[model samples]
Target: MTDRIAMIAVDWGTSNRRAWALDSDGRVLAEMGDGEGLLKVDAGGFARSFADFAAPWLTDDRVVPVLMCGMVGSKMGWAEVPYIAAPADLASLSRNLYAIAFDGPARIAIVPGVSCIHDGVPDVMRGEECQVLAVLTQRQMRDACLLLPGTHSKWVQVKDGRLDSFRTYMTGELYNALTSGGTLAQLMEKGEADPEAFRRGLARAREPGSGALPHLLFGVRTLGLFNALPRAGLSSYLSGLLIGTEMRDALAWSTARAVIAVGSPRLLENYRIAAGEFGLAFEAHDNSALLPPALHMIARDAGL
Candidate 1:
């Protein structure tokens, strides 16, 4: 690749797509964002979408090398890049990447997602690896636990800047399903993050016992029905239950002292609250802060 070659890094998930054109130093030269997420675009129209967003950079002698992560590599995505199992470094991830040609002028590379088998459970992650790589680049820790809060939250364990293992929780998805789905959906009003109710839910989740979640959820519903819990607090209560349960499960396997959470401010704030409720120390890093560093790591690993 020539020094003039523009490198584009993309993070495409289910609902949104982001692209950055970077110089050799990995500084963002130009950026584009759109709602043409993998789930929303037709497989055949991927090239068109790529061309439309990247047309400006494709001119002249700039032969762009595009590196993408997230659902773009999923079975339901443009192309399925098979996963690289855990205990992986940037090199391993780069080696496992799937490349395909677009009839367009640019060269495209899709970063393969990561997966791992732990005690017979198959775990998978897409865009979070970039966040992990970004964390390793930014911090000097020898070992750490990174929590990525989103629709599918990931608790990743890293040792010496390499991914050791991780787990995924369906916290956000469950929250959405319960809020938008049938009968029980009408029981609560949304749009408020009630800290008090959240705290109450967190306390209930921290109680000792393996099977307390179901009973607790039942009680939440009962409280709503009997005018015990305010309708406005129901959303926060449910959020706490899901996140708190995740915290319980994450703490079971985590041995790291410090936790770095990556996500939006609202999500990270919730994570901070949950961590505090669990007596764990944590620092929140916005997901966008990791983007440029992750692109640099991808360049380094791919020798771009």
Candidate 2:
């Protein structure tokens, strides 16, 4: 590799695309991104979209190595990079990655996501693996629990710098669905997180039993129906119920040295609060903080 080679790292997700140009020292030289996510771009036009965003940095002498992550590795995106089952390290993931050439003067390599079979169910992830690996690299935490809160909250268990196992919860998606399509939508108002109501719902979810979810959901309607809990707090109540339930279940197998929460501040804060309520110790870091190291690891692993 040339000493002055410009490497680009791309995190292309369902709703957005972010690209960063890095120097040899892993310092960001230029950054560009847009909302032309995989879901928005035409299937055949991915190369064009990427070229449009990366064109200004392209030079005749430069052969940029692009390390991509996110939905770009999915079947609906550019090319399907099949996931490698965990107990995986950076070297192993890079060795198993699937790459393709671009019409432009660049060497493109996409990061393969991770998948694991738990209890006979196949669970998969794309972009979040990069962040988790990045965190592991940065913090040097040998064994830790990684919590990524989003549309599908992921509870990942990494041991000795390798992914051991993980589980996914549809807390955010379910909250959206219930608020938008379910009958609870009419009884709730669009509002911010209500800490008090969230605490109450969390307590309800932590109860010892198998039918906790159904029972709590029943209460969501019954309370509204009987004018027990305030109508405005219904959304927050439901949010807490789902998140709390996830936390309760995850606690059963959370035997890590530390818990690392990654995501936006709002979501991380809620997770932090929930963890505290559950008597768990955790640290929260914004998702962006994990990007640079993640890209660096990807580049190193890809031999860029």
Candidate 3:
């Protein structure tokens, strides 16, 4: 923990923020995180908010290098960094870093997000681009599909070590909204996972005539009411249904031969299960691989 710090790597997003103090060799020396997301930090309060977590590094005499990614570079972040167009790689991302002029000795750089025009519609991502780079670089992958699952799941394609295209799904958000209130929530608790019920939900999503999700979601309540699904395990069923639909939608856009799932164990397992049910190939990746090396590469390339 007392190692000489080389750089501060940060992953700041909408709901939370985390930072790591890395040594000269890109080894993490210490780490910290807080729930003060972009939404919680008030207007013109980014510097103050950041200092709360990174104060120890932002000293008077040391020009501690800091590299940040995610929503921290968005319009609502400390600075509104523009998004780098798609068909980009680590080089482009590093080149477009938005440097924040700190009055102190800390040198701050924010990684730009990625954007693309898909089928005449605009799509954007704030944080997952870094994760994509980390995976592609570490695996020496030239072309592949990468999935970062969370509230807003992302399906990204990397070609020739560059990010080519991506799409987002609100699977987790929809699950939260549906399970937080209404008839479904009333009958459900944070139930122990029922693998059978979960499979049933996935099956429902894949059914030949299952119709749209609105109708399928309504069936969750009906199944509970009719005792078709146990009330205690209704939550898992809803989760499977949403995740299944997400996979179904994403399959159409993903051109890569196989998909790499990147997230926590639970998240990766869920996506793996869904991918399996869909008969799609999947590989689990360590989420920890996303930040440290990616930040180091960017900082080194940028001459930080």
Query: Which candidate's lDDT is highest?
Result: 3
Scored against the true structure, residue 110 in model 1 reaches a CA lDDT of 84
What are the per-residue Cα lDDT tens digits for candidate 3 across 142-169? 9898899999899888888899989888
The Cα local distance difference test for each model comes to 0.83, 0.83, 0.85
Once superposed on the true structure, which residue ranges of model 1 sit more than 4 Å away at CA?
A: 1-5
Candidates in descending TM-score order: 3, 1, 2
lDDT by residue (tens digit), candidate 1, 1-304: 2345458888888889988878777877777788988777886888888889777778645567788889988988889888998887788887777887788767788888888888999999988998888887778665789999999999999987789899999899888998887545788876667999998888878888736666777767887899888988988988888899999989998876568999999899988998998889999898976876686677667775
User: In model 2, where do residues sit more than 4 Å from their true spots?
Assistant: 1-5
Give per-residue lDDT, candidate 2, residue 267: 87
TM-score of each: 0.94, 0.94, 0.95
Residue 119 in model 2: lDDT: 85
Candidate 3 collision pairs = none
Clashing pairs in 2: none
TM-score result, candidate 2: 0.94
Better of 1 and 3 by TM-score: 3
TM-score of 3: 0.95
